[model samples]
Every structure is written in C-alpha cells, then in structure tokens.
Target: MPAIIYVPFGVYIVTDTVEIPVSSRVIGQAWPQIMATGSKFVDPLKPRVAVRVGLPGQVGVVKIQNMIITVKGATAGAIMMEWNIHESGQGSAGLWDTHFRVGGAAGTDLTVKDCPKLSGKVNPNCVAASLMLHLTPDSSSYFKNV
Candidate 1:
C-alpha cells in the first residue's frame, strides 16, 4: 500500500512542520505550495521546513511531486529526505518536479541523509532526471534531476 497527501494549487502560509511517514507521499495540484508564516525564529531547533519525510529506519516508497516549499523563517532545511537500511528488498522513493525557495536570509535548500546503516553517495539534486532510491541491504542510491 502507498500513503499519499494531496494539496491543491494555491498559496498557504504555515508555522508548523510537515512530517511524512514511511511509504507516504505529498502531491501538489499544479502549483501547490507550503510556506512559512514567520520571517524569523528565536530557537534554532525549531523546524522551518515546509515538508519533511521519512525516518532513518523506515523503509518504503515515499514520493513528493509537483510541490513548492518556501521558507519564510530561518529554521531547518526546506525539505528533508531520509533513507534507512532495508532488508525487504522491495522499497523505492522519489521526489519529482518539486521546487524549494527561501524567503528569509537563512535556511538550507534541501537535505538528503542515508543513516542507520547505509553508505555511499546520494545525488538527489539535478535538472535532467528524477530522484530514485531503493532501500535494499548494502545498496547505494544516486539521484540526478534538473
């Protein structure tokens, strides 16, 4: 089974973090957006991400497509995609046609981490191809999209 979150095309100002579980997806209708409400933050640990997904040990197919995430405050990264160790040999994940921007002076564009027993390089930012990840034991993931 696949998990999905759908947002219609529009502008939305938010002040909370958007977390995605294993096998979950976030879809945008045309130009759906997720933006922050504030312009700054007092605490650094507070998340400023418009969308977040997955954990270090959750293995499944997670997708974020056709969505725009904007950061209005200086907090966490715009989007975070995490990968974990998988022995099931049947897992895939991707981010398609997704865009991120920072309205504030501080913030990261994106962060991709392979933790809890995974190694190698993960290239998820490119303009030519989409990001594709397979969570298998002793496997590496390489993504290129532009």
Candidate 2:
C-alpha cells in the first residue's frame, strides 16, 4: 500500500540525499522547508541530489505538495529536487505548490550581507546550489503551482 507522509511546518536540514519511494504521497503543512547544508553537497563536478522522488524506471504514483526545498552554506553541487519516477497514469506523479529557495533566507548565508551586490568580488560562501530541479530523461511528472 502507498504511504502518506505528513511533514509539519518546520526547518528540516539535511546533509545527505532524502529519497521518496514509489507509490507514496508527501504532504507538507505550511510549506515546510527542506534545507541542504554541509560538505556533502560541495563538489560541483559531481552534483548530488537533496531530494529524490523515486528511482529511475520506477513508474507509480508519487505526489509531493506544499513544500519549500532550499540550500544553505557552500552547496554548489546540490540539486535540490530530482524527479525520477515515470507516472503510471496521467497526472499520477506530480508536484503541487512546491518551491525552491536558494538563498536570502534566515539560515542560508547567501544574504545581501554575505554576497553584497555589485561588490566586484566573488563570495564562495554565497554559493547556495548548482541546480534547483532535475527531471531525468526517464522521468515524467506533472507540476502545478510549483
């Protein structure tokens, strides 16, 4: 049977990839933020995923709603969300009201103070992430208000 994972409003920090299995629904209340930090996601050449919807070639119902996926610290290799599940049916796998915020937040050090605009200087600490979402070649999904 499919499971419904409910994430209450809060700041969830992760240093590794968080994967969601097939045939599951993740519903977040009040747009919970999933922030990625630490050295785990620092290698730009070898990008890593923070949230993976499903494994490649997995076809099933995977729904994610009302969430905020972001990156903090020097996460230049962080791919915030990766959707790898092919929908079993039309509109079966989808994301609704899910957002990705790279920086300029409370925890993320990429604020104006750290990255001063037009400073004519590059700040490595302000490098939040390399990519926001990764929809793999074998993946197909539906997005609404995301």
Index of the highest-lDDT prediction: 2
Please give the CA lDDT of all the candidate structures: 0.47, 0.92
What TM-score would every model get versus the actual structure? 0.55, 0.97
User: Candidate 2, 124: how far from true, in Å?
Assistant: 0.9
TM-score of 2: 0.97
Per-residue lDDT of model 1, residues 1-146, tens digit only: 56678989987766655566766667889967666544332233442333445555565566667876654433332332224423234325566787655432233232222111243543323111111222334433322241
After superposition, the stretches of candidate 2 with alpha carbons farther than 4 Å from their true spots are none
Quote the RMSD, in angstroms, for model 1: 11.8
- Candidate 1, residue 115: how far the Cα is off, in Å: 37
**TM-score quality measure for candidate 1:** 0.55
lDDT by residue for model 2 (83-138), tens: 99999999999999999999888778888886889978777777778889999999
Candidate 2 versus truth, CA RMSD in Å, comes to 0.9
Q: Model 2 lDDT vs. the true structure?
A: 0.92
Badly placed stretches (over 4 Å) of model 1 are: 39-42, 45-50, 73-91, 104-146
